[model samples]
Target: MAKYIDLQTFTDARGNLTVVEKILPFDIKRVFYIYGVDETERGHHRHKKTVQAAIALNGSCRIMNHAGEGLPLEEFTLDKPSKCLIIDPEDFHWMDNFTKDCILMVFASEYYDKDDYIFEPYKQI
Candidate 1:
């Protein structure tokens, strides 16, 4: 099952800290960022082996998920630095319509591999 984990962010006069680390729940093997995104939608893809923790470091956006079967499509809003949406490998996920200046960060359980992704609106094999 997909679960939402609210990360811990410490704020002070210096700055705010929202750290992503490897722990029991997630062993962070890779990290990536998605930027230069317009107000339009993008990233309608799903991974076959990678599990990810998606965070909104700046601005806001939404994440939609649909499991392999006729699972109900669920939507989650990313607004705060302390919130994250954890996705399992079997779930189809996408990030859409980000705010103009949004910076999306992802913590993954595996390194980048071209074969790991399946672009969305695609036939399920």
Candidate 2:
């Protein structure tokens, strides 16, 4: 399952601020941003242990969730800057239907390691 997090935002004459703490149930060890993707679908795997949070910064997009929990796939629309999707470990995830100039900022609780990820997709049996 996924967790929708409401980030704290402050606005004034200068600009707006969305605050995120890297501590609590876990700590942030990696951060990255995605942009300039029109037809590309990113992320097709589940982490072995790392947990992640995805935040949309620019345009809107759809996130696909397919965790191996004997349930159907789910879709989430992320369009707000303060809206975040918290992806649990072993939750197979992907992104699609990105609007132009879409930016998705991701924060993770672990470093990037090829061995720490599962990339096999579901197959009919």
Candidate 3:
């Protein structure tokens, strides 16, 4: 599995903003956005070489992830203004139970390629 780098955010009396100057470990090569309603669960897939950082820019969303040989599945709920979840290769991830106007921002090391994606259904835990 790949490593995680959590970006830092600072807040003051002015406002809060995410800083992305020269702290990223990898060069950002691609960006994607997912926004809308999720009546059912979605994104049960794996990326062979894509390392991604997901941020909830608007509303909240739930993320389910499975990584490593015997690593147990984990779930995360993101709703803060600057909180984010980093996902690495070999991890199966999905988004579920999102709000009506939830906005998900993803930063990737590579562009989108169909050959790099692996879709799978939710299995027994």
Best-fitting candidate, scored by TM-score? 2
**Model 2, TM vs. native:** 0.89
Ranking by TM-score: 2, 3, 1
Q: TM per model?
A: 0.83, 0.89, 0.84
Record all residue pairs in model 2 with backbone atoms less than 3 Å apart, i.e. clashing: none
Per-residue CA lDDT of model 3 for 66-105, tens digit only, reads: 8754677888887764776778867888898889878988
lDDT values, one for every candidate: 0.78, 0.85, 0.76
Could you tell me how far off, in angstroms, the CA of residue 24 lies in candidate 3 after the best superposition? Answer: 3.5
**Prediction-by-prediction clash tally:** 0, 0, 0
Q: Residue 14 of candidate 2: its Cα lDDT?
A: 100
Tens-digit per-residue lDDT, 1-125, candidate 2: 77688888899999999888643257889999999997989998888899999989989899998767566788898998888998988788899999997899999889999899898865412
Task: Please write out the lDDT profile of model 1 over residues 1-125, one tens digit for every residue.
Answer: 46788776789999888765543276888989887687667667788898988888888888887776656777889888788888888777778878877888988889999899887653443
Cα lDDT for residue 81, candidate 3: 44
Q: Pick out the ten consecutive residues of candidate 2 with the lowest summed lDDT.
A: 19-28
- In model 3, the clashing pairs are none
